[model samples]
Target: MKSFYIKIKSFFHSIEDNIAFYPALLSFLGFNFAMLMLYLEDKGISAFVIEHAPPLVINNADTAKTLLSFLTGGIISIMVFSFSMVMVLLNQASSNFSPRVLPGLISKRNHQYVLGMYLATILYNTFTLVGINPKETDKYQLPGFSVLIGIALTVLCFFSFLYFIHSISKSIQVNSILEGIYSKAKTRMIRLIEKEKKESPSFPDTSDWKEYGSKETGYLQTFAAANLINICKENDLQLKIIPIPGAFVLKEIPIIKASKAIDKELVEEILSNFNFAQGEIVDDNYALAFKQITEIGIKAMSPGINDPGTAINTIDYLTELFAIRLQKNDDTIITNEDKSLIYINTINFSELMYQVMVSYRTYCKHDMTCVQKLFIMIKYLLLQQTNNDHYHNSLISEAKYLYDDATANVENEEDKRRIEQLYKSLPNKRE
Candidate 1:
């Protein structure tokens, strides 16, 4: 039952991440509201309201029909224009930023809500217009209140459209994107730190464990750690997960090791707790935020784009994220109430630093400004470092690599000398 609940939770999380979820939900609400209005009109509720309504309120079917018709056309145009702009923005983001960021942009709640509002207004107006009886003389069935509501919704949507434009403009800005990624990464790191600080039982030894291979191949989006821990506790098994979330695993590759051999059925059942998808989602896996930020920096420094300013801004945000990561623990362990059940592997600080810095060095090595920025970033990180000699050494190694790249690629003697000076000033340079 716990496993089933976890599956349900994961399913909802996936839906929440989908771009169309909110819009579809709002569209359904609009359709149902239109149906309810029609029912009210048939029951003479609209007729009674029309009789008592003020002169400004649309009481005649012909006027309401014309108004709804106009609104429908106007909203349809707005939807088309908004969708076109969204497509253009997406294209710009993909070319100038990173394609990985497209999901974050697409799943933006404000944009989705605005689009959904437009859809709701259109659907409501269309359905309300159909329910109007222009030729009925005995009892006019004009949905005046419904028409008024539609008009109000249209005005609301108009304002929402304006806000959407402003929001999209800001969303596509490079600095905004980098800050968003950094903020999310920092939040994830904080959560990890809090989790690590919690008291938990030590993991049992599993040196003689039997390894279980996964049946699928893709990015390990997420797994039910709590459920897995409970399962291990119930089965009297000690498990070690070999791959972290955001890792790519291959079919028949060992993903988990157990204290004892398990049957194929149990193996498949255990694998069911893991979710693998074709692409990475930053919300589920924080490490993907680092990857996305790195890609954005790379794209900014590319020959075709040649926007070193944006790359430098990205470095600033990454430097902040690395500072937060520096103070966090590297291990991931989960246990049951009183006993250790699972141990999972996660990317250590040094590896994450290497991955991000290497990508920056590979792309921005020729740009002296970026090279200098890298040295400064490393210097700031060095100050944030604890007594972890290994981490400090890693920072020093990264600095040397940045210096070497700048030496080989930077042509101007003055710029090279500046980078050399920056490298020389780094802590532990002699080591």
Candidate 2:
């Protein structure tokens, strides 16, 4: 039963991540609200409004029908245009930047809400239009107040359209995208740092721990951490996640190490808590942001694009991220208050730094601007707060790699001179 519950929760999370969730939900709300207005209309809401304020009610059946029909058509047109704009946005982002960014943009709640509002407005007006009759003898039964509401909703949508345009334009800008990614990555990192300081613990030797293979094959994206914690606490077992978040896992591969051998049923329940999917979502995994930023930098440096400015911006964000990372320990350990339950062996700081710096050294080494920025970025990280010598050594090592690339590939005498001077200026012990 717990396994079934986990699957249900997992399914709901996937549904919630989809772009259509909000639109479909708001559409249902719109339908229900239309029925509600009809109920109020049956209760003589139009008569009450007419008695108090005559101008607020729409008594003429032809006027109500015409207005609702016209607004409904107009809303449909607006929705069509909005969807087209979104498609174009996705295409440009995927082609020019990186395809990974599309998930972030697609899962944007604001855009979803705007599109949902458009759908809701359309459905509300269309349903209200169904009930209007020219030959109804009673003016109070005309759904006059309801027609007024649809008109008001249309006016609100006009404003929403304006907001949507402003927001979408800003979202498409590369700076905004970078900042958003940076902010999210920083938040996730900071949370980890706090956890390390407070609840972290040294675990007993796991060399003898029983290894368990995954039953499914896909990229391990989100781990249901809260649910896993409950299961661990209740079962009095410790779990170690083998592959880091954002890693592709295969069936019958050892992806978890349990403190003891467990029954098949328990193993299935534990594995069900891990969500595997095709792509990465940045929110659950900060590593994806690092990867996304790196990919954007690589795309910019590609010959077809030849846009060095974007690459420089990406370097700036990565520099700040790395600096924050210096404050992190080499390992990530999540535990309950008693300092026992979960041990997540994440990609260590050294490995993450090596991966990111190697990519920059590979792709951006030819561009003097980008390579020089890499030199300075390494210099800045070397000065940040860290308790580990290995992390410091990693930065120094990355600097040496950048220097070697700059020396071999950089052709301009002046740029080579600058690289020489920059390499000389590194922190003395780091040499």
Candidate 3:
């Protein structure tokens, strides 16, 4: 309830949020105008006189008193009527479903339009109360009084027309504006892919690459291989592993075939000593394969921030890859050094990825929209991931570092107290 009140207050404080204010003001204006018209009619000067002001002053004492009463009463009644209408609109419009009509009215640039309509309403109602019907005026009504009522009604209708227009304007789709933001995000993704490509090595079309086998000949594999080749070329590194026919063997395998043909004695000796099977091929590009696999897997995981389901699906995909690699007999040969760099582009990254699943879960469990929570969580996770790349190997270590940095910034008493409280709230640190 307190949070709700706070939001309501903040909304009213901003001019942009005036959608809830204008309709209310309009109703108030309308009622006030009606009362003013009533007062004008009660005065010695008929609605006709007020409608058509005489050039010469011919006011009697009684006429002056009557006019004064009419003016006072009409103004008071209009105020009351306006207030009543404002209350009605406020009660009718639910914030969750309908746009606040009152605020929208206040947002308009034309105050004169608002004033004129309400003023006319008051004049018309005042004239009517005084028995001056414009349509029936020809029978017995004074000209000015009857015409004033007609004028008031016209003003009321004009205000209504403007309100209708404003309603339509407010209802216009805002999706294009949202789409513009998404466009920037798409561009950023494309740029990142391009940058990584530029920085990475390309795969060589050697016989060794063929050893990863044709099963690797997919769009994702091609892109990953290209990235690896680009990285190698940029770094001036030797082809870490040469491509060969039929399935890539791990880089640690000592019996790789040379890029060019070598002496049979040396090839046979090396292959025989390293436990090579007669049919086994040497030029396996395990480095390229691993790097490519990890990169593609990360790309698939990137969309999980806004969508929990996407994150879960991505995690599942990476989990399969990790499991496959673990199951392979040669996988045990992947050194700690090689595994560290590869995981960033693969399954390990998902453990620290944004808790999109948690956000959706919270939303379902609680009545909250969770949009803001999801946004903050995603932003924090991205920052943490980037920082982890900067200073640490594991997610847990990076998270601890972040907590330490945050703790070090405490200066004031309030901040120190908050820090202490936060420290207490933290989970036990993993050794």
Give the poorly placed runs of model 2, Cα more than 4 Å off: 1-14, 429-431
Clash number for model 1?
Answer: 0
> Predictions ranked by TM-score, top down?
2, 1, 3
Worst 10 residues of 2 by lDDT: 1-10
For candidate 3, lDDT tens digit of each residue in 273-390? 1221222111121222223222322332334323333333333332333323222222111112222111012223333222323323323212112222222333333333231231
Q: Over the stretch 1-431, how does candidate 2's per-residue lDDT look in tens digits?
A: 66467667876776676789999999999999999998998898889999999899889998889888888888888889999998998899999899999888888899999999999998899889887888997888799999999999999988898899889889988888888888989999998888778765777778899999999999887777777887788788898888888898999999999888789998887887888877777877888888999999999999999999999999999999988888887666667777677777678888898888889889888889898888888888888878887888888888888899879998889989999999888885354
Candidate 1: lDDT of 316?
Answer: 86
- Cα misplacement distance, residue 390 of candidate 3 (Å): 20
TM for every model, in the order presented, reads: 0.92, 0.95, 0.24
Off by over 4 Å in 1: 1-3, 51-57, 138-140, 200-207, 411-413
List model 1 lDDT by residue over 34-133, tens digit each: 9998888778776676577655357666777888899889988988999999999999999889898988888888889998898888889988888778
Worst 10 residues of 1 by lDDT: 136-145
Question: Candidates sorted by lDDT, descending order?
Answer: 2, 1, 3
